[model samples]
Target: MIDTARPPSVDPHMSSALLLAAAVAFAAPADDLDLTPGAWPMFRGPNGVGVGADPLPADLIRPENLRWQVDVPGRGWGSPVVADGPEGPTVYVPTATPDGTQMDVLAYDLATGEERWVRKLFTVAEPDFTHPTNTYASCTPVATRDVVFVHFGKYGTAALDTKNGHTLWERRDFECDHFRGPASSPLLVQFDGLSPRLIVPFDGVGEDDQYVVALDAATGETLWRTGRDPEVQDVVPDLRKAYGTPVLAEVGDRTLVVTTGAIATDFLDPATGERVWRVKHGGMNSGSAPQVLQSPLGVASDAVLVTTGDAPTSLALLATDSDLTQTKGAAASDPALAWSSNAGAPKRATPLLLSLGQAVTVDDGGVASMVALGSDVDGDGGEVLSRVRLGDSYWSSPVRAGGTIFTFGKEGAATTLETGVFRGGADAPPELKVAHKSTLDEGVWATPALVGGGLVLRTEHTLRFYHPDGTNE
Candidate 1:
């Protein structure tokens, strides 16, 4: 629940007026820097589906395969985002001081691991306590050609010029009591007739404060603010907080904002903040973002895969056009509930959607499993196909390049799995095999980005770029 009675320090009216004044004299011309096949613009690339077209080297752990490595200034867990700029392609990452008082975003040259610029955005007088495994800068940024948007939970959200790293606009009035820390990254979406909007979620454990807000991308002006369902307020405060990110999905002819929260997954109209449909999974502390399943027939299924954080189960909810609701237990009776699984469901890492109509998930304990997504059109639930033990803890979600799946362990171990061929037919089970395994010097919690035929990764204290050979293309 958001504390509506507490007055914000910055008046919304004044903030809007200042933003309008600055836009007239100094706003960069918006360009078409939309998500491309080569750019990793957001948390899990396009549509939150973690797959890259470029093929990484079979063995990336060998020292000779390293392209370049650089020591980052501060600590952060947010993954690096890559975009093409006038000079060349640039990598943007967020970091902060150990005390969490100072936060900044660092830009580096994609070709060579050289620092381009650093923009310090916030200086908090008193900071809150973050989880031991989490950092002050856990929210990954979203980028375009002209501007990059970064969010630091309750501290603030700001937009910066991509070329020179200058501030375009900032907003600090949003309120939330993130007891552990903030990890939900913002989403950028543009409808056919609507302007580009940055959607930010504030699903903290505070009272009357769990809501989602959309801001005009050109300027930091609030367009709509929608609160969570009032029924969520009835749960315990800890059960109300969530750290999952949002993804955009096409349902029929309309686009919907599909997001996961404490007890439910919601589908909302992107143009308006109205709820279109919802499914209650009866779980808390959801950390994994929802993933849309694509059928083997080369079409999007009407079901989305979701996980209930800190719970033992994950679920698949059927997407519909009506404003109806269903529960996880209703799978036996309700057609809206497609399936549910308790084997190797992730608590932090988002599941990867495979091409063979199967979903792969790595639990926080380093257990990975493959589950079949039952026919979404027929309302059938699936079962766990296979399970494998990777032998190390994982917080970063896995990404696929070509036929190999990359899993990052918290202890700095990197493992690649070869998705064996389905010899029989398309419906045959997959033969999972471990391809290669290697270890790094430090722990890594940030997900790596694949771009320009190279992999960009962030560990505890440094950022490294790796390619097949020790040369930058």
Candidate 2:
């Protein structure tokens, strides 16, 4: 027998009660910085770690504590970064026009919800192919104490003054097909200690093939150029999974140029285009950027970490030595599968590897799992100690803050989970905990950008400021 519970009755006589059963899905923005102490300046908050260093309460507010939620124009998946020049900390958002008529990046004030500045900088000569989920501003802006850098293929790269929305320098001459639009976020590296280099890459094929360009930070002039063998494509190669930006890490006397291909991971000399080593982790459709881990087996050894996947298997960590370019390294350090789980790692959201080398991921299924980076073999490989299945998929990577991990799904559900996962090589997995959550419309895909005082949260059409506890001013 099937028993179906039904509504008993309506308050027919007792005057009709009017109410709005609020229904926007909740997607929690990261509280990675302090609303009273500091601000998130670039891609991964302050440094490129994708972590908010805020000491606020882990419990973020819902409709109650919300300072204010305001709707803006344009649509894209790029997170906002604050450039504190003279006008305090101004939030910068690079948005793309839907019909391709114009592609602009805008700025806002963190203190009160207000439009600080709008810069209609790039106009695509001809828009390139991109994934349904990606946008022109997919690449988050990079900043220094005085400049903000944004990359727009065909349209070129540009640098803006932090004080006023003045063009510091602009480079609208580079040419490369951003097959699936551009998602590689620019990284800032200090030249001597003050000078910065804006490293950005683009696609090309065959003899006149793919390339990664480096521009002088202060001035958007072409400082140097490095090229790669064109990815042999039968067709235009749906470049979506093929390209990525460059991330830096010191290895020996040189910094590494770990660049993601439509499907390949290559290491290049930052000073020169010399590819020091190369490793191919299958699947061309790469969404997130690559992360490096020191030889997990121990310290003092030579090893690097890489993750790839889209429709197929997603998370993978490849430990390689110098032989990777040769047949030996590839054969010897065959990727030791760390943790494989289909917990909804987004096809567009990059996977964030924590300091422990363990993967902190939010899968396409709206499920977030903190899988330990296992060193053990098959029979007892590794384990995903902590996980919480959410109700949506987030193209934005979760920002780590206050011992908790924060991620937002498609509908805008912000899930806060206690990180620190442990494999039960001897004990049991940890319990799942929900720190906070909030609601929003469809486009909160941009990863949370920690800013002055509060964390900046945005949808394609709306932007907001969230305090740690559920309090909205």
Candidate 3:
């Protein structure tokens, strides 16, 4: 149950009647959960590419642009997800107690900041050791027309009917050591035009027990399982763990599931969970995900970009000589080396590949740099396009919206930069132009969500909605 009785402590407040109406509207059953075109369904936008074309304001620093802000309970790094229903839209966010013993999910009205519903899912008797920076609620929720899936890594994974506050299914038997904490989020992928499968990365703390598990999205049953056996042994056991999510890419007639792990990146058949090809990288415990590059026409290319973990993090491009459909064997049919670069690779935040033949990488220390892509970037052709120092540390990945990349630091400052297009060689390298800078004045580690021409940013204690017109309910 949600506390609909109280008046929401929103900054730059609105009328009480409007908030009450919005809260009451949440009682209606969700007829549909399918995300509309302007809705943000999951992490990094719909496709996890970090590109959002929402019509948010160019400058959030403008006091008139912030619509409303509401305080959230507990601590979490998981981003908010928006799902459209028959009435309007609802934003779902998950968080947990500071002790990592109690986990809960909260629903809010997208328009008025009304408390919709709150559901508690788990209570651990003896929680595992997690890094001080990481919380128990680090995995984001994934939603569709019928169901909303919430995952807390090793704690449990559950499905809640978005229409009502009903727990449809729960799976708590999945085991993993996580070493630091659960940072990987759940991803949904469809196979053979059947029901979609929920993919969860269960990379354990040691080499002997890492696996990629897929569960039936409808029933929460085991759909398929793929184990990762990286033969490389490291002195540190945590180096064998990975906190990265998997991305699905279509290669010609074949669909490949590309995932970066502790010591290597593997491409697998999404249907059968069979490894197609793999490239070994010496870096251990990768935290960033692999991004499948797309052509200017938005077509999937054969090249995939990945970032290695540990110190001196490096970025590598793996391009297949032939169609991936015709490839078999992990190491036998490995792709040719396109190139590897160590310039400004983020250890936790995933990189974004723009349509302008450039990839944006933001390091934890706030160094944002654009590198020229394609097979030519590996050679001595001056790949580094431009770099900007934002003077803030960032833990969340940046999102592209309204032709601007919004990079939010951990301490709540957001830097907006224009994404200039890069045509080809001999052209002046694209510069990272600073468009605007704003601060939520709190801590922000979760990736922001853009939906319905609005930008939703979550700080350590508040969720703020920003729009171009600064319309507040």
Which candidate comes out best when scored by TM-score? 1
lDDT of candidate model 1 versus the reference: 0.77
lDDT of 2 by residue, 1-473 (tens): 10113221221212222101111111222122112212555556644566665644556635555666777687777787876545676788788887555778787767766786788887766576665866777777775545677766655577766556567567665566665566666666553322345667765433333666655555454544565544435334543345454676555445666776655677665554456665554555565666665665232223444446554445555444333323332344233333344443445556665655366677777877665555432312225657777777666777776576778877778777775334554355454567777666554677787654457787767888886554433
Shift of residue 319 alpha carbon in model 1, Å: 4.1
CA RMSD of all predictions: 5.3, 16.7, 10.9
lDDT of 3 by residue, 1-473 (tens): 11223332231222444333322121223333442322677788776788776545558546687777788999998898888744458788899998899999987778887787789888998888878988999888886655678999889888776766568667776667888888788778764444466778877675555778766565566656677765744546767777777887765566777887777888876555667777776576576668886555232346778887775478877765354323423343456446677887788888877777788888889999887765442343216788889867988888887577888898877888876634455566667878888776786898888876778888888887777778664
Q: Which residue ranges in model 1 land beyond 4 Å of their true spot?
A: 1-26, 29-38, 296-300, 319-335, 376-380, 421-428
Write one digit per residue (lDDT tens) for candidate 1, span 1-473.
Answer: 12223322232334656545433222654444343222888897777788886877668756777888899887889988888865678899999987799999999989898888899889999999888778899999997767788998988888888888888778877788988888889899875566687888888898866788777777777766777888889988988988888998766566778888888888776666666677777777777778875445233445678887865456554544222213333333222655566666888898888877777888889888877776643444457777778988998998888877888899988888777554668767786667898998988898888877878899899998888867664
Question: Which window of ten consecutive residues has the lowest lDDT sum in model 2?
Answer: 18-27
Give the range where candidate 3 is weakest over 10 consecutive residues by summed lDDT.
19-28
Q: Which 10-residue window of candidate 1 scores lowest in summed lDDT?
A: 1-10
Clashing pairs in 1: 1-207, 1-208, 1-209, 2-208, 2-209
Off by over 4 Å in 3: 1-38, 232-235, 297-301, 321-333, 377-382, 421-426
**What is the alpha-carbon lDDT of model 3 when measured against the actual structure?**
0.72
- TM-score against native, each model: 0.89, 0.78, 0.86
